[model samples]
Target: MASAESASLGRKVRTAARWSLVNTVVLRLGNFATGIVLARFALGPAEWGVYGVAQTVLMVLLSANELGVGLAVVRWEGDLRRFAPTVQTLSTLSSGLLYLVLFAAAPALADALGSPSASWVLRVMCVSVVLDGLAQVPNGVITREFAQIRRLVLDSVNFGISTGVTLGLAFAGWGAMSFAVGALAGNAASLLGAVIAAPGAFRFGWNRAEAGALLRFGLPLAGASLLALGVVNVDTLIVGATLGKVALGYYVLAFNMSGWPVRVVSEAARRVSFAGFSRLAESAGPALADGFSRALRVLVTGTVPMCVLLAGLAAPVVGLVYGHEWLPAARALPWLMALGLTRIGCELAYDCLVAIGARHALLAVQGLWLAALIPTLFGGARLDGIAGVSAGHALVAAGLVVPAFLLALRRGGIGVRVVARACAWPFLAGAAMAAVLVGLPRALGHSLLALAAASAGALAVYALGVLPTRHALLGVEPRHGRHARPRALLPGPSRPPVPPPRHSSESDPEPLLDGTGADGVRP
Candidate 1:
């Protein structure tokens, strides 16, 4: 009976991870398409920069408001349905409070940043945050229930509707306000979708037992989130302060362009990985190690070449995507790509560590890195403008790699040397592809046709090179584990049925990493 249960749980995790990954990727791609259009037609660099700052501020505040309740809810090993109302009430109240705080402080915040216009932007964005917060707990419940496709559809519909609305406003020359409009539209759509698909009322239950238990777990998670966000956004804040709105706009453009590649790949990986690791953590040491190893391989193999390709193709890509006036972004691309790659490394370690019940370790590492990041950001922004921001990011990336490797080694018993060995081939292959792309274009006089052919050829070569290397690193083709694969979703050869580990305790362990031996996996 125990073995059968474990097997069933493992299969469920595998299936959920795959679907979640697909849904995330599809959603991101849809957003990406709309973003490209918006970036090109709807907003110029300065307007885009303002939009970026507004959006970034809203995101930071949103993260603060949720205060890690979603993770706690996921970590809740008890009855998810029973916990749902409490989570909903808590999240809604917290968000409402945050909205009040943001609105009260908006004028002062705008003055502090020397941008009076920010007050209006901040006020508009606060509305979205509140609505966004209302959805978090219900979203968490849906995720816990393994309803990823529904989540995906909700996200798609929200973004699709918002994009359409925002584009119409942009065509009418609504400028920076267009972004705020789109964000409001998107949040409203998201709230509506959450209500329809996963209905839950937000009564202030204030269940002391439930709220207290969640807070104990959630506060640390919240701290970790704040530290991480602070590190990531300090550059923007500093750039905005030191460079002013117009220059900050350019810097943000570069920053966003640089981060997009990593976002594309990591976003999908994270959704699947969090749930999958939670499920696998219940198994024994060897099984956990195997899962960790596979996850790392997937992250590195996907992220490294993307960084390399983006770095190499930075100029052309910027021209193609955002037009010629935004050429400054290219200067930051290589550094940003490098930063993106290290971020992928750190994230892999983070997911594995978190899944294996190392929340304290996760918080500590994130704090240390954020501490290191502060001076790097301020000094870099002051020194060389936007490029300085990239320089700081690069420095942080370089510093973070060793620590991440060590943590993965310490927590999961993954060897540093083994990681280095696995990374070697992919790094080499990426470098080779970069060289070919760079050399071929110049040699052929760099026509658009020539560049296209060279880029295509380089991609083909890189793909061929990574295929064998990936197999060696992961012990199988990654396509085998891809969430979108029908065979993978079905029971198949790679997914041989394995028995669940036996348990004779008072309760089954929660499947996710929850600072305990929980046997349940929440996405």
Candidate 2:
């Protein structure tokens, strides 16, 4: 029985990872393509700068709206339906209030950001806060249920509509307003889609005890998120204020392009892992540690090569995709891309901490990261400008955040050695790929065809280098061997079987929140 359950959970994790990967790739590719069009044809440095500053402000303020409540819903072990209304109500009230505050303070924020046009843009974009807040309840429902297909469908629809509208407006010469409008439209579409797909009673309700429980759980996570937000955006803010909007535009563009692999692959894995780990914790199974190890192995293996390629091809990629005008961004791309490798592991550790209800530990780690990040970013910006900022970011990520994450992992019962072992092959593979990319002839012109061919060759080399470790990468051998029965990463007595719940036609049945549903695994 224990073996069967372990196999079942493993299958579910794999399924979730597969669909999550698909969703992330589709969404990120579409966004990247659309951004290319906007950057190359529709917007210039000044316009993009203004938009970037406003978007950064919006993102910081938007963190308040999130407050980790949605994540709380996913992590909660009891009846999620019972907590839905309270979460929805609180989110709505908080978002509405925050938007109002932002509306009034928009002018000051714009002045501080050194972009007067950003004031109105910020106000216009505030509508998305409320829209996103309302959507979180349904979004949480889908995520908690591991309904990846529904999430993919909803996000695809949202992206299609939003990108179409943004491109149309940009072509019409709306400038930064296009971004605000597109964002608002996307949020609206996502909310509608989420509500329709994940049907639930999401209404205003006040449950004092439930709300307290949620706040207690979510507040520390929120602090951690805020600290993270500050770390991410502070450099952009500094660049904008000190170096001017055009320079800031270049920096933002570089940062985005460099961080693409992390956003696409690492984030996908984190989302799925969080859901899977939450379920595993509820089951009190040793798979929590095993899942963490395997997920880290796969995430590192998958992301390292992509990051290496991005760093190696930074020049041609920027020239070809975003045009030569944006080539200055390439200078910062390599360092930022290197920084992304560290981020993959840190993200996994943070998710593991959250899954196990170690919010305070997560908070402490984020605080330490912020302590190292701010001074480094400021000094870097002052010393070498944007490149310095990127270098500083890379240094801090490797020196501080990575170590902090390993400590958090240890606190969560995962050993640093486990992660190190998982990382060894990927690092070697990535190093080989980087060497090939750097050593190869620079005779190729900066064209899409040239870049494509080079990327293919680099990927081939990486594949060959890592080929012998295929079983580990694919999770085929588990901790033993191919034919051995799967065992948990940590030794423990098997959990007693949980009795099946009784159901009646008269009483509406609640679906099991065991990361599965009647159809199969929910993912």
TM-scores of the candidates are 0.86, 0.89
Q: Give the alpha carbon lDDT tens digit for every residue of 404-514 in model 2.
A: 878877877788778888888888878888877766546576466766777777889889987887776655554544463433222221452332222100000111111
Per-residue lDDT value at 273 in model 1? 63
Best by lDDT: 2
State, as a TM-score between 0 and 1, how close model 2 is to the true structure: 0.89
- Candidate 1 C-alpha lDDT tens digits along 293-383: 5666666777776687778888888888878888877877788888888787676666666655576876787778777877888788778
Worst 10-residue lDDT window for candidate 1 reads 509-518
State each model's C-alpha RMSD to the native.
Answer: 6.3, 6.2
Give residue 378's lDDT in candidate 2 (0 to 100).
79
lDDT of each: 0.64, 0.71
lDDT for model 1 comes to 0.64
- The pairs that clash in candidate 2 are none
